[model samples]
Target: INYYVITTFVFQSAIKLALFHTFWWMFSQNSHILFHEMMRKIKYARIAFGHVLFDDT
Candidate 1:
């Protein structure tokens, strides 16, 4: 009975850790993609602004 109880506890903890790792991996991947998209947009905006300023001059 004691062994059964210990095994169950260990199984539950292992499942929880796996789930946490999956969630964290997904979150990081999504954030990395978002950051890249934001950087691209900022770069484009800066180029456009520079062109406009040059045109004005």
Candidate 2:
């Protein structure tokens, strides 16, 4: 029983890792715009939250 559970968990983990890796590869290769947008949003959010201590304002 324990062996079966271990095997099942390992199999699912491998599948999830593979799927994530493939998706990341596709995103990295095809669309940099989404990545850039996410970064811009993060920057804005930091500024809004006052995480960035220095600003021209």
Candidate 3:
């Protein structure tokens, strides 16, 4: 019984650590992609607004 409990505890802890690492890695990757997409949109918006302002002038 004691051995089984110890093994179970170790297995649970290992799975938790692995899940934590995977989630962290995924979060960082998603944030990086989102950041780049936001920048691209901002750049495009600026160019579009500039054209509109230029036409009005």
TM-score of each: 0.48, 0.48, 0.47
Over 2-52, each residue of candidate 2 has an lDDT whose tens digit, in order, gives: 755765576566556655665675577656755665566556555644532
Better of 1 and 3 by TM-score: 1
How would you encode candidate 3's per-residue C-alpha lDDT over 1-57 as one tens digit per residue?
A: 575576557656655665565566557778776566556655765665466446533
lDDT of residue 47 for candidate 3: 69
Q: Hey, what RMSD does candidate 3 come out at?
A: 22.4
lDDT of all the models against the reference? 0.60, 0.57, 0.60
Q: Candidate 2, 56: how far from true, in Å?
A: 68
Off by over 4 Å in 1: 30-57
Q: How close is candidate 2 to the true structure, as a TM-score?
A: 0.48
Q: Cα lDDT of model 2 overall?
A: 0.57
The residue pairs that clash in candidate 1, if any, are none
TM-score of 3: 0.47
- For model 3, where is the 10-residue window of minimal lDDT? 48-57
- Which portions of model 2 miss their true places by more than 4 Å? 30-57
Clashes of each: 0, 0, 0
Model 1 Cα lDDT, one tens digit per residue, 1-57: 575576557656655665565566557778776566556655765675465446533
